[model samples]
Target chain A: MSVLVYAENADGKFKKSVFEAVSYARAIADQNNTTLTAISIGNVAADELSALGQYGAHKILNVSTDKLKNFINQAYASVIAKASEAEQADVVVISNTFSGRGLAPRVAVKLGAGIADGAVSLPDTGNGKFLIKKTAFSGKAFATVELTSANKVIALIPNSYKVIENATGAKPEDFTVETNESDFKALLKEIVKSTDKVSLPDAEIVVSAGRGLKGPENWGMIEELADLLGAATACSKPVSDAGWRPHSEHVGQTGIAVSPNLYIAIGISGAIQHLAGISSSKVIVVINKDPEAPFYKVADYGIVGDAFEIVPKLIEAVKTYKASA
Target chain B: MNILVCISNVPDTTTKVTFNANNTQFNTAGVQFIINPYDEIALARAIELTDGGKGAVTVIHVGEAANEPTIRKALAIGATDAVRVNAPAHDAYFVAVQIAEYVKQHPFDLILTGRESIDYNGSKVAAMLGELLDIPSVSIIKKLDVDGANGTVEREIEGGKEVLTIPLPFVAGTAEGVAEPKIPNMRGIMSARTKPLTVVEPVEVKASSEIISYETPAPRGQVKLIPADDVAKLVDLLHNEAKVI
Candidate 1:
């Protein structure tokens, strides 16, 4: 049996998260001593489909149909399930992105496979059982889940692993799934792209502020710092709830959960819900006036000071460093 | 319109996560449970959508009798009635199967669930129910509006948002912005006790997965406290020591 992975693409180009998912699947394939096949749905260039080979995919199944031009959860799940069955896949992996989150569970139901979403670690096949570690309780804790079903589905969290290059030079073979009108029940009416400087999920560094910023007008320095570092600007739930920031910019347990390489919190007291969302961040830096702020406990670096005074200086320092380098 | 909102009772967000019984089970001692926050949002939206007797909102939970209080909270918040499938929410598959079975006998025009449970963070129930019932399912919807027999929903993607239209008899996992949660007023709380709270035995279904154990996150190292005045030093440490900048 082979391991199957759904190679998600955006506007015909694969994102870094897709490669990371393929890399994770490759490791699992190696562990199981099986081949890995990646399925690409919608319209993707031949070269783009072949790129999956770089991530250890022995074969790529390209499903470029006009009917499936846009992402319909039901249709995409049907396509992935069909591809998995055709390949005799025992394990199916998908990136835990927004689209993948919607598609994975449906695929699991269609295939009658057990699923573990937000998986942070590869399956531990020790003792003849498959146990996978996943983030639970909104990243506050971890749970090791055992998938007893023979066919299993896993949604790998973004940034959980680095992408590795393994050249397989695999060619893309055309794969097709029969579709009826029912698959298109959910019609995509329109798409609205955010004009933000940097997307939070894909950002390497995130500059987030809480209500401690005092007012929405004081956000100039936070934006300046984010612009200098090419980072996304996020806010805590309170700030968003108060209308200081858009709800999309809110990062916390009840909001968007992000795990960037570096997360810098400015004037944000570490609420447990807010901390739970960013605990997976690689490095955390806290800048607050209160030393008793709980954020410093989990931070890699802490500076007890006012954001108005400290943020400008930090921004200038980053500017100087960039200029000098 | 009859709406079905599925709720999960989870530990309060502030509870410190811990494990017991050789790490095989969550330590429930001295911890408080509440309706999952995301599910609360769904329930709130369902109540708003069915406001003024336009329709009825039904909340269903798959858990033991101990979670009845949580179900009552839904009714207090404005659900027309409640149902509890008498079983533990062992896994996503098992829970979805139980809900689907109950819904098969008692169908609804619309079904809503939280984008993901705060405890397991598994966004599986809505889509699974969609497949089992042969209906379209959308996940993590930020906005939902009903007009006639069709509903419009907006959901965030990686770098953008998408708005879609689906006919009635569909499922959706609600996120923030769907509706602000409503608290239980005294009048509503009093009336909730008289509202129907139906308990039914769970259908025969085998869980496809189980949590083998639970573990807390590794403790972080000591923070390197830097004076606020010396921002340069902190920047240097970030670049050289942490290599993150």
Candidate 2:
């Protein structure tokens, strides 16, 4: 059973997270005594395609279709079913990004496969049983799920797996995928970027603030710190609701959940809703005037102080450290 | 403009999660169940789309009798009727098949669901339903407008948002900022009791996946309290010890 990994690309470039998924698929393929194949849609250079070989893909199949460019879910899922058929793949690995969340299940249904989403680690294949660990209860808990289906689809949670980049280069093949006029029916008219700043999903560090910052006007220091640290800026629900930040920046139960390596919470009380989003974060740093803020409870480090004063000092420290380095 | 909103019954966000014997079943002893928060936004949007009694908004839940209260809550919030598929929602594939089968019989011009249930966080059913129904499906949508048979939507993509237009007989998984939830008023709550709550047997579909066990996350370690004024120390720790910077 050959394994297939869907490496996602944006603006004709492969995302770093996609390689992580390919690396994961690589290990699974080797353990099963089978070679893995990587399928990328739209466009990428021949070198970029062969770069996936470092993650141990035996071949790279590029479905260079103009119709497949804008991420129409139905259209994209169709490409996957066709590729899986050609590759004789029994397992499909995908990065659990925004597109993965939209694309994986549809592919599973088309292939009659049992799908697992938000997988935190590689599957355990031993004693004639395959078990996958996935974050359940919104990140509150993890569930060991067993896919009984022969054709299985797994979307690896981003940042959980590290990509390996030392392997033989895979041969790149341009495969033609058939599409009907209806494939382009649901079109993406335009894309409006939220910011040129680091995207939230892939950001290693995130600087987030809440109502404690008072008003939108007070975001100066928060933005300054995020810019200095090269981190994405996020907000609590109330802050976004009040238009102090875009709703896209809201990280909580009702917003975009994040799992960065380092998540710095400034002037935000950690409600359960907010906590659920970042519980997976490797390290949490919280700054709040109220020492009893619930966020401090889950934080690895805490400072009881005003964010306005603290953030500026932190920004200066980060600036100096960067300059010295 | 007939609209169908898919609702999921999940534990409240604040519920302290626990497992039963061998972690096979979720111990639902005292845990309160509410309409999944994301689904609430979709339900609210569905109600507004069918406002002024222009059309009907039907709520569908794929769970056992235990979800009756949550289904009723949807009716109270302003759905015309409710349907309960008699079965446990084992996985997204199972739930989507049941809803797809049910909806094909009682079709609606538009369908809505939360981006994903907060519990499972699968974010699958909507697209599966769209595929099953062969209609356009949009995810993470924050705005939708239906004029005549055409629909316009704005959905969040990776680093940005996109606008798209699709015809009627479509499915959409909504996110927050779509609409404020309608807390059932006294009249609506009273009327919800009289509103129809139909229980239907689930369509037989094999689950592709099964849960072997469940585990809560590891507990947080002791927090290292840094002095309020020690900015350099924190930066030093991040770079040298934590190595995050």
The TM-score obtained for chain B by all candidates, in the order given, is 0.97, 0.97
Which residue pairs clash within candidate 1? none
Number of clashing residue pairs, candidate 1: 0
Instruction: Write down the TM-score of every candidate.
Output: 0.99, 0.98
How many steric clashes between backbone atoms does each model show?
0, 0
Docking class of 2: medium
Off by over 4 Å in 1: none
With a 3 Å backbone cut-off (N, CA, C), the pairs that clash in candidate 2 are: none
Lowest-lDDT window of 10 residues in candidate 1 chain A? A194-203
TM-score for the A chain of candidate 2: 0.97
Error of 1 at B222 (Å): 0.5
Model 1 iRMSD vs. native? 1.0
lDDT of each: 0.92, 0.88
Q: Model 1, B33-142: lDDT tens per residue? A: 99999999999999889889899999999999999999999999999999999988888888899999989999999999999998888899999999999899999999
